[model samples]
Target: MRIGFIGAGRMGAPMVRRLVGAGHEVRALGRSGDARRRVTELGADPVSFTAAVGTEAAAVVVCVFTDDQVRAVCLDTPLLASMPGGSVLIVHTTGSPRTAEDLATQAATRDIRVVDAPVSGGPPDIDAGTLTLFVGGTEDAVTRARPVLECYGGPVLPVGPVGSGQRVKLVNNALFAAQLGLITEAVRLATRLGIDEATLLSALQHASGASRAAATVAAKGSVTAFNASVGEFIRKDVAAVRALAAELGATMGTLDSAISAQFPDTERKS
Candidate 1:
């Protein structure tokens, strides 16, 4: 399939490589000089971010930093006109599902297909095609999205109709943020009680309390301590989760207060 990608950054560049390696023709653009070099350097059909990726593409992939970034490029772009009816436009960024629904409503006028298809796992998994992807759209749209999704991940499940993917992905991130706090505090308390960091991690890795993040923080403790600046990232994710919770009339009070109290402003790594 011929693919056009908007936004070339950490996640976007690697994804373009994955698609190119999977034998798809990728027309890519970057919003900055550094990003442009990285994409073209990796053998993609590269252009400036403003270059129109007008829709000869079988699929157009949108990956940007924020929800607004996703809208500015995909929803606001005139490329939707260049797209022939029935071509797929998949959103890979995570935000409110409302945007997906709104875009789908707007795109339908042109017969353009839109799907909320946020990815999970990490950058390493994206490179290895092992990320767990959640897709939500019409059953037909999910079916059409499968091939493109497989280029970067495994088990792209159709969870529900449009925006469901965003909901699920948001919850998934919220859970991780919640867990990070629990695990960190558990370890901190253990230390206060005189348990060693390495020992605590090793035991937790095999215990019922073990978590996906436990192994990561354990393996990289020294680095996580010095470089991970985890507190700041926790703030960003906590913010995303909190916004979603508010939209759903759920409370993010505990999560917010804990992070505000525990994580200092200077130490944020994401």
Candidate 2:
């Protein structure tokens, strides 16, 4: 398969490597010399955005940051215009559900298929081909993109129509953010009771209250340490969730309290 890829950063680079290793002809959009070198090192043929999508391809995978970047690459550029009729555009970015729906509508005019295929896990998961994809598209679109998605995804779930994937991903991230708050507070409460941080985390793992978020906090040695590493990213996702909730006139339910406690400033800003 001839594949066009965008965003060769931490997550994107490994996915490109997996595609290249899977015997696909992977051409990546490289805007800078360093970006080109990085993708090349991963066995991709790095090219400009125009060249990447200009040629006929079986699929194009986008793994950029932010909703704006996804729109810029797919809508503001020549991507949708240059892609062939039957090719599928798989978006791996976690962003607005509306972005996917809007792009799908636009791309449909050109006979191109669009799949909102936001992924979970990190670079290591991509390298190991264990990343999970929350896919949203027509049956035909999902079927067409499945084989290529399987190159790096373990479970490619077709949740529903065009924007459903992003909806699910947002909810997933929001829940994770809530879990971070719960786990962090629990650690604090344990400390107040004279229990050691390490000991409390270890016991929790064997208890019914054990969770992935708790494990993550434990691994980092403290909530402060974990937040220092990923708080900004989590905050970004949380903000997206809050925006979507407001747009839909929906509430966050219990997630509201968790987000408020963990990210007071962000909650207030939203």
Q: What is the lDDT of residue 206 in candidate 1?
A: 92
lDDT leader: 2
TM-score for each model: 0.88, 0.96
Error of 2 at 219 (Å): 2.2
Whole-model Cα lDDT per candidate?
0.75, 0.88
Off by over 4 Å in 2: 268-270
Q: Model 1 over residues 1-270: C-alpha lDDT tens digits?
A: 888888667777778889999898888876677877888887788766433564578788887767887778766767677677888888988877888998898879988788888887667888898888889899878777788889887978889999999888877766666566566677778889999778888898898988886776676773247226454444554566667776677775565544443444523222
Where model 1 places Cα greater than 4 Å from the true spot, the runs are: 49-51, 222-234, 252-270
Which tens-of-lDDT digit does each residue in 157-269 have in candidate 2? 99999999999999999899899888878878999999988899888888899998888777778888888977877887888999999988898888978877777768532
Best by TM-score: 2
